[model samples]
Target: MTDDPTPGTRCRACGGAAGTVVLDLGEQPPWDRMPARDAPLPDPAAPLRMWLCAGCGLAQLQTDAAVAEELHGVEPLAMTEQSDRSVGRLARAGLVRPGGRVAEFGSPHGGSWLPRLTGRGMVALDADAVSAAGRADLVVDFYGLLHEPDQADALARRVALLAPGGTLALQLLSLGTVLRDDQWFDLRHGHYGYWSLPALDAALRRHGLGVHRAWWYPLSGGTVLVTARAGAEPDAGTRRLVDEERALAVTEPSGFARLQAAADDTHLLLDWLVAERAAGRTVAAYGAASRAVPLVCRAGLDASLLAAVGDASPAKQGHRMPGSDVPVVSPDELAGLHPDRVLLFLPELLDEVRAALPQVEASGGRWVVLGPGPRAVEPVSALSGC
Candidate 1:
């Protein structure tokens, strides 16, 4: 990765001067660069700093350099169940109709919600192809805008692709929820910007779009779903959410203080992990999600502290973590390997992992989850492990 011309200098949304530095994650490798077992790893690391825009109150990553040409190189784990649920929710909210033309942006192969548009006409396109895809009744940009360098321009393109009064659905990580919980795992190199309800509403309103409906899903830690239409006005619910976010001090300096404090405490947790390993206690990790690359690096965890990182996705198995030599193994091997304790990278997928590795607990193994706070470690009971 090349150095950003103006590192930690400007906001991507409003182009304002860099605001308060809420959380500095130090230097981290690009999260998506998973190298093959025999391939040499990339040495470049960029500063992962989150800045709050004073002008628009938008929280964004300060790295202006593009890490990779494409965000995702392979297909992500399919969330068919969640897709089905979202389809139902949209239908109930009257955003999906029988014959409506729908376009899904940033959808990976085999993981798209396009199948849900059974009777509707649907097309799936990457961020760059939206201009050529023409118009649609519903444009769904799932987890796309967060990685955009110029959010205003990207959103303007989305608006151009939407038919008059058509719905534009954006599924993104909720900065309000992430900040409130102090979840640093959501802060990674791949995301260029984070959006709160107010910031998103503000951006949409600039394009003559208004929030029509919104929902929050607890999946992937926490995600916000907002559906907007061209001429619609911001509803009372939208205003209420904006007020609540403001009350949480989403853009204030104190909010950054809380995050900085949590980050400070994370180092203590890393110290504890190192101590545990020195005591001859075996420690491994579950899930090799891309976000884990930065978390593991920031925590100073290496192959020495962790035995191996296990992931269920075949795409990631047999690969080495980008900046480290830690091996990514199949989750099935966890029970057989039988580490004394396994640190879960994705807390949201804990139950699924427990079900898959029932014998890990039965054999006196433990699971550790880092969370809502830096030092917040919730150890799963040996009895409830399965």
Candidate 2:
């Protein structure tokens, strides 16, 4: 609320002035806001950065640039597919009990594991039905923790909602993967904290929950579904996850400068787009995701280098991406255009999108994966002959 964000001295989780700046991405608009097609470019960009809390070993946004308005997006087919596979893994692992009470904390963007729970014979409860605390056998929050402004309070509530021996299932972006993979863009306004199992173990223990078990997945760069229960200790599997994190030295503040280095690579995407343009190849992009905003804006992209972007969500189609003039179109329209190259913003969704837009390849267009490098990862055609 001041001219600049407070020099973040205190840890968001532990309330200790025991942290240091790790990454700093200069002034950026609220990435979540998609402006009206004719609206002015995003204004009043503020400093975007991440900090490492030595006290709790948590990585967090130093301060919020602005209060964000939720941008509704259709849950990608890949996310949906991951949800099914994750829940099925939980059931097979015996973490899910038959006919138990299930409570969910869905992301603001909207998606829930309740339907999957109900299919597993568990009873799903609405938010109001959950206030009689500690009643749930399973309290699930996938991709929900980072959105919370108050990390301490959020953890407390998720803990309080659990019954004795209840499993609080959390799917978090594994900090080890973030640092090791150079996914620096994950640092953004509105994302409060990044969790390593070590830091999270400290935070959860404060709330009477202990890390119990974990499962890793290659979604969203990398993700982990960690189970925490009251009075539990780090089980054998949990210890292994923690040990892997230690090997990466993720909790150290200086090691985090790697992200600052990645941020300096903003020109990478623009270079690829320019090459495509020189070849007279018309280019479009897919996914108007929040993470794509910083990358697109930082690279100084416009409708010229990157043409229209296709999104599955109707709410976003008529709007332009914030800070740029690129129009958002529907998926059907995206494939129909048969662009020479369609840059996919979210690499983790590569498979699902390939199947969804088979026409792009059938007509001689190749789908290019956008990331550290814009490379054609799939065969010339993914689904055509199959």
Candidate 3:
């Protein structure tokens, strides 16, 4: 498949200079949404050096590589998994209480939550012409564009479609988080506009909607979940979130530095693992299909040293990790290989995995975690994987 666009140009988000080169991931293919094996792969293109916008602190491409954006199709499954908990929480929090009406912007092929909401009387809307068909009380084509008269008309139509006293919930990535964190990875082609707190509030107000609540949720580093209502003015909650975001200095360089250092430390851990292998110890990687691929690839781990990367996703089992090209398999394979150590890629899943360690121990192995922070190793039977 085609690689990420090279970086050497001005920032598209902030029009700032591309500052210091933070990470230079040479040639690598896309991850997460890789196509089925039979699907034709796009021409390979290496992403040059990725840069940080010193002014806005957004990570961005200097030039468009392949049409990764245009190639993006509705990842309904991914979105459904990511937003299900957020939606359930919002419902419990009264944003979409029983009998409440709602509209989701850029709704992916009728999100899975659409059925859950429809069961409770909520309307689901999609701006993209292409979408997955799912059960919802109402489904409408709604697009989000800027400065376009058509966009204004669509906004009006969506807001008018909402029942009076109903809430409009928005699940959009926060540009403030992306920009401040220099998460250039967030600047994927699929995402067009960056929605800062002010920008989101202004958009809601312009469309005759009032912002009632604005909060941060961790979806791909960070995202903002906002609840709005027609004719309601922007509330203090929105402003408070914006001010707090600023006060927290979420965009400070320190965060990027810390992440970079963490990446470096993960590299050190992988290096140690490779050395251990050279000294005659087998290592099997656990938890495939994670955000750690970029970090692991950047660390230059040997693919052969890894017996097989384990993941629960059937979609990922036969494929390989992006840059490293390590084969992915199911956890059952771990017991077969019987490696001395299993590198836990998903630290969040540690508890569940630890609970299953007694079964995994049939292979007689230990585990290590190369998380976002540092490397920690412990015998599989030691801490219950907590």
- How well does candidate 2 score on lDDT at residue 375? 82
Task: Give per-residue CA lDDT, model 2, range 1-386, as digits (tens).
Answer: 11124554567788877667788777887877788888886555777878777677888888766756777899987788889988987798676777788888878877889888898788886644676653788889979999988899888888777877788989888999988888887777788889998888878999988888878888887889888887776768778989999888888875676777787887888898898899999899999988888888888899999889999999899888778999899999888777998888898777788788878877878888755778876654454455
Worst 10 residues of 2 by lDDT: 1-10
- How much does each candidate deviate from the true structure in C-alpha RMSD? 4.0, 2.9, 7.1
Q: Between candidates 1 and 3, which one is better according to TM-score?
A: 1
User: Which of the two candidates, 2 or 3, achieves a greater lDDT against the reference?
Assistant: 2
Better of 1 and 2 by lDDT: 2
Q: What is the per-residue lDDT of model 1 for residues 290-350, given as tens digits with 9 covering 90 to 100?
A: 6677777777776787878887677778877767878888877766788888888777767
Clash list (residue pairs), candidate 2:
none
Candidate number achieving the greatest lDDT relative to the actual structure = 2
Which sequence of candidate numbers ranks them by lDDT, best first? 2, 1, 3
Candidate 1 Cα misplacement greater than 4 A, ranges: 1-8, 38-42, 69-78, 107-110, 119-134, 234-237, 372-386
Ranked candidates (TM-score, high to low): 2, 1, 3
lDDT of 1: 0.72
